[model samples]
Target: MERTLHLRLTCGLLASAARLTPVPFLDDFLGDRARRLMVDKTLSAHGRRFPSKQVAPLYADPHGCLYGCLLSAVKLLLFPVKKVLTWLFALRYLTRDLSDAVLLGRALDGWLEAGRLADATDPPARLQEASLLRSAFDNAVAGTDMQLLQGLLMKALRGVSGLPKAAWHAVRRLRRGGAGADPTEGLSQADDDAMKRGTAKLGAALETPEARAFLEAFDARLAENVRILEARHASG
Candidate 1:
């Protein structure tokens, strides 16, 4: 569990940093990859061989897709305004990814618990459980006070102020090169180092008093809700 949390943090940082890439849509691609990586690692820890591709459809549905699209649209609308203020943009991006990481980690935990409560070989049962888990998770996320997460993330980013600024500069450098900049090649060692530092900072942030307090409240509610849902399903 501790290892999974750390993996989520690293992946969150990587995903957030991916947004700094100047190429259009590349950030979404890299962010999805980071999420898949988190899923893979979490499954591995549970001794489950289910690859992310196989597990994806279990949790994915029309509503989830719709929610994701809506989120993307919102971010698109805000990009221009947020882009002008590097610190605000960085904080928003970090909050987005890190909050996503927290939700995904909890969802993975619920999925694992679902698998444990049912026959591991029963695909249908597992699918049903995943569906229920997804619904619960989606509802919880939608109802969550996102501003609380943004505040926590702001506090975290402030702990290492220079890193986000350096990352912002790297993004600007890539943009200045315009069409000539290959997104893949645009990342220098300095950019990589900034990402590494950011990742470390994120991990450390998770251990802070503020983070722990938030997680305790959020995780308890999410976990209990999931458990009750699973229990009712099993009884039925």
Candidate 2:
């Protein structure tokens, strides 16, 4: 669990860095890669090697994809004046992407554990799970206090300019080790402080009632499927 937390925090920090990209869709592309990496690492930690063919389908969220397209279109339209407007939108992006790492990480971890308990062998099961999880998550976050989350994360990360460097180092270490590396290691004093604070802030947000219900709801969904599978196994 500690290792998984580290992975999520590291990936969240990496996603936050996408705000630095001057090109809009480029940041989205980079953020998507970070998410895929998170999914792969999370599943690997659960002792399941994710099939390359399933990666795309497992991460597909129809609403998120549509949002991404609309976001990219807006960015393109404002490209000429991004220097003035980027900062305005950066906070929202950071809030969404960072929280996504935490939320998605937790959801994937729980779902995979349920799959294991049920002896689920088919890869397609993951796609079905992903669809339900994504829909549920989207609804859950609709009531979240975006402004508060943005403020907490932004304040924590504001003065620590070396954060990007720390994130980069963590990414390099993860790639080198492939798994089990702490994503928050080797940071300078300021970077470390910011990371700790930022992480705590994220935790606080996720501990909210809405967030708690989301996890519980997903858990119930998984438990039902597990029971069904267990019954099938027993019958066979």
**Collision pairs in model 1:** none
Q: Ten residues in a row with the worst lDDT in model 2?
A: 174-183
lDDT (10s digit) by residue, model 1, range 46-145: 7786444555532233355668777886767776554456345765778787788866776676667655423355666555555666666666677677
What's the TM-score of each model vs. the native?
A: 0.62, 0.61
Candidate 1 accuracy as TM-score: 0.62
lDDT of 2 by residue, 125-206 (tens): 6555555555555555664445554555556556555666677555444444533344446656776665665566556655
Candidate 1: what lDDT? 0.61
Predicted candidate 1: what Cα RMSD to the true structure?
Answer: 6.6
**Residue 116 C-alpha lDDT in model 1:** 49
